[model samples]
Target: MMRMFLAAAPAVLLALSSAQAEPVAYEFDLSHTEVSASWVHQGYSRQSLQFTDFDGTLDLDLETPANSTVDITFNLISGIWAGAHHEAFVGHLNSGDFFDTAVSPTAHFVGTSFETEDGETGVMTGDLTMNGQTHPVSLEVTLNNSGETRDGRSKLGFTATGTLLRSQWDMGYAVPYVSDEIDLFISTEMAVPAPAE
Candidate 1:
């Protein structure tokens, strides 16, 4: 019994250690960033779009870096295409042909799994929901940078990209000139928690 107790000691201690530290929460910096998307419209020409706001929470445990997860929620109805394309782009995007924002006002992405493919580059599998439809997708992510600055501040940043079939979510409206491929882009910057005061 003493030997069994000794063998179980480390496992029990690790569990206690994990339970003591809470997940780190970080807010993204939007000012120094852009959230944009592109898709082929005429098989050769590409069209681009961007959203105005992104609100979400990210939870990470530096010890188990691969176990981190991020929840991002964005306003679909507030998206802007930025040009003379506003009228047709917004109208059609909000219509049944694209996002159908009238039926779904928001889009959400929640991380599920992480995998490494190359040196410091990886993939994050998650569920992406838009226009009342949800689908499992993976994003190619690269850990651009992570470290502490001279100001006693810690930081981490990454950029992710993915492509999804528009028709998978019922966005099949194409005038024979539009494409069904949608390119997604995500960039994030995070800092450590505030010091105890």
Candidate 2:
């Protein structure tokens, strides 16, 4: 009897463990998403108030928290400056002078690595594609929280900021007014989801 009980112990443990497990998934609801870029001009800084669209996806594992990633997309054509009424500004920004949004209407960020610092804040290394140029961009990230809700939705929220030089990406424009330093501000609330079918 002792030998038989020992033999069945492993199987019993596995069954109990499997029975107690519940699947957890979180998603990013892009409707609550925000993506913006800003640059200094002379002595003042201004931000672009418009974007065509933004899309993102986050797959998180709470147990294995380190195995997570962020994928973000931006619509260059949707950038609105001057309340979107400045045709010259829009024309200049899209005409290879700055963004060249006509040729490349979208930009993307894919995080390849992450490191935490001072608790929840840290840096994320990723590829940021803009103006048809790909560069390794490091951005400061802040992860607020993540959890499963009563509505059967698991979600995550975060804020990320980064700075870039316009001249590096051939995005240089602005004569003596606008500064070369560009800052990106992104606040996101995302749902956990697999790829779209």
Candidate 3:
């Protein structure tokens, strides 16, 4: 009995430590956030697009980083292409050729797993739902900076990048000519609201 207890001690301690770790909740700062993408156009130039509206929540567990979570939603029709043919580009993106925003106006991402090295560089895996389709995706993230605001609100800043094949979502569009792979990039600041007085 004594030997068995000794052997189980470490596991019990680990469980206790994990149970004591709590995740910090954060609200995204929409005004300073950008969820954007880019891709090679006709194998000649790169074109960029940005989602005009998006919101999300993040739970960061400093003690056990893998316990972190992120949930986000994007307005599909809000995508804006940055070029001279902006209006035409946006219209095409919202049509059946791409997102088909009429039937699927919203896209979402819910993180399933998270891991970090040195608590600053990390990879988050999640299911990305777009145009009524869902696929597993991974984002490489870096904690650029973090601190408390002047008013004592906790803040975190980070940037993440990922890539997805548009064809996987039935959005083949122009395929090889327009490029099937889309690169995603997100940079934002999040703040934790102060507790009620």
lDDT of each: 0.60, 0.55, 0.67
* Candidate 2: regions farther than 4 A off: 1-26, 63-69, 79-84, 193-197
Q: Summarize candidate 3's per-residue lDDT along 109-182 as a digit string, tens digits.
A: 77776655455666667778888889887777776677777899867677777788889989998889988888
For model 2, residues 57-162, the per-residue Cα lDDT tens digits are 4444343434544566766676444454678777777778877887887777666666653435667677777788877766676766655455655455667777
Where is model 1 more than 4 Å wrong at Cα?
1-20, 117-119, 149-151, 193-197
Q: Model 1: how far is 103 from its true place, Å? A: 1.4
After TM-score superposition, what is the CA distance of residue 20 in candidate 2 from its true location, in Å?
Answer: 13
Q: Which stretches of candidate 3 lie over 4 Å from their true place?
A: 1-21, 79-85, 194-197
- Give each model a TM-score: 0.79, 0.71, 0.82
What are the per-model numbers of colliding residue pairs? Answer: 0, 9, 0
Q: After superposition, how far is residue 38 of candidate 1 from its true place, in Å?
A: 0.5
Q: Candidate 1 lDDT, tens digit per residue, 45-109?
A: 88787776666667665456444556777777775554674786677777766777788877777
Model 2 residue 172 CA deviation (Å) reads: 0.8
Q: Tell me the TM-score of model 2.
A: 0.71
